[model samples]
Target: MATSESGSDQTSSALSDSFRTPYYCEENVYFLCKKLSASGTAAADGSDLFVVFISNEKKQTPLWNQKASKRADGVVLWDYHAICVQRKKEGDTPLLVWDLDSSLPYPSPLTSYVSETFQPSFQLFSEYQRFYRIVHAPIFLRYFASDRRHMKDSAGNWTAEPPKYEPIVAEDGAVHNLNEYNEIHAADVMTNAGDFLNAVFTQRLGAVINENQLEEFFLKMP
Candidate 1:
């Protein structure tokens, strides 16, 4: 577990170290939590980081009500949104939830966000019922970084050729070939300013109504 001084600016350092994403919340938060867990476990005392993945299935959640592009099926999918939860074993710092979807505060306190999102007379975890899913961090890390599919080589090149995949045998005696999962995971390390700009902004993303031509167009935004 990481230590922190309450009300200090130090806690925000973790947020700064979190890698940028192409507005892909699922991949972004997964990678961020993995990085934080690895870094936070190196304490002098033998304490490990605790991170949680919160999934919302209720239609009333903020994600389900977002104004952005949603699925055409008129149903807010569970995998559509995800947030990283971290509880520090330090001071009185509240549990932090990282939802980088632009609509919610980047690093929001868990309770505060829950209060805002849940029903008016909600109890912490009791009222959630079947609408919430919680998975321990370590177990999730197993499935997350199991392969180097989206990663690069030592010389800064694509790790492997396309159609790169792993083989798996299904329960029904069927063999399935799974492609390199992260082949298109938002361009691992942003190539250039243009790449960064294009990855983040869509036509109507934040206040900019038009698609940007280049990085300069984004920099000049009010």
Candidate 2:
């Protein structure tokens, strides 16, 4: 991994150039997962690619080390954010997190990413607490669709420029279903750890987990 500051900056810049847009984190992560799947770095079937959605009931998620923040601390309150996590079957390799908007290393180790980005040790109001929804990348890539409607103002002005590329459509031809992935509720969180893990890998919407459970849940993945 790129441990030096300069090396990390270069790697992050290159990844941003390849897969990032101004405000389309979901699409950025979608393409990232697609590339990882095609690279055959995960299982041959790409079963190890996971997409993580971060937000809370109030849509206020405070993440540190984001490129979008002007604060000296690099903390940003995003309505929602998306990132890709890849788990290698090899026991010696740590899981990796690919976040286009993060100022962290291009592919930070899952533990480091969770610690620095989520800052679980930092206390916050209930509304500012973060929740996560983890989806199997293969299933997400097949069913995730977006038309960029979420970026518009009430009068239909673009909040930010849409990606130069065409909007993403699901394999089944569905479009504009972005809310299904972004809207995570605490009620949806699974109480049983086994059920949560199973749903995360097998269910369409996957499972919702709280910030405290994020690291543990992903670490438990095989």
Candidate 3:
């Protein structure tokens, strides 16, 4: 994945375009970020930058129509969405997240973004479930752990020595190796100038999200 050393917006957009496809966000964050960074290093604070993919526990609202909700036993379905997160070093500076589709301020502080994005329906027992993986790009790429990736802390960040690509189980129980997976799908996600904005409008992919939904989500925040 090639990127230009331009402004942050361009850089971010470039990065997102390179990652927006169905599974690239997950794979690239674990494998590509550090290699692609202009400086072959971590941030000054020693905290690693990360790319986070998130979604409600359901298949994406399909382009044509929403899918009927269904779940068996312990199965969890995932839709598609990705963002950039940078851990704060310390001091008063806040930990922030960057999402291209968000109406909130770009690079939103984590506390505020979390409070606004997840709103419970009931005060007593309402809890929305979310699953995430955070890869510590620098350490994982440099000094890897013995496991494919190891949990280093409660924040869900992972660290591990880069693995030699091998057949791994996918969400649907299919076997795939990262190398083949990227070869097939990477081009599908890579975008040229203006391609992303066009996809946003034409595909109705939540590029222009509903302000009312955001307002309602926040209004219910406590």
Ranking by lDDT: 2, 1, 3
lDDT of 3 by residue, 1-222 (tens): 221222365555565455332323344454335433543333642334554444322423111111212322212232544455555444353356554444445445665665544433313221223333232444333322222222134675543333345423444343333322112122233223244334322331212222123323223222
| TM-score to true structure, per model | 0.42, 0.91, 0.37
Error of 3 at 121 (Å): 6.4
Off by over 4 Å in 3: 1-8, 28-32, 35-46, 50-84, 90-92, 99-105, 120-128, 139-222
Q: After superposition, how far is residue 61 of candidate 3 from its true place, in Å?
A: 12
Clashing pairs in 1: none
- The candidate that achieves the highest lDDT relative to the unseen native structure: 2
Rank the candidate models, highest TM-score first. 2, 1, 3
Q: Please name the candidate that would achieve the greatest TM-score relative to the true structure.
A: 2
After superposition, which runs of candidate 2 have C-alpha atoms over 4 Å from their true positions? 1-14
Candidate 1 has what TM-score?
0.42
Per-residue lDDT of candidate 2, residues 47-165 (tens digit): 88889999888998899999999998789999999998878666554588888888887777888888889887899998788889999998998889999999999999999999889
* 1 against 2, candidate with superior lDDT: 2
* Clashing residue pairs in candidate 2 (N, C-alpha, C atoms within 3 angstroms): none
- Candidate 3, residue 209: how far the Cα is off, in Å: 28
lDDT value, candidate 2, whole model: 0.82
Model 3, residue pairs in steric clash: 144-160, 144-161, 145-160, 145-161
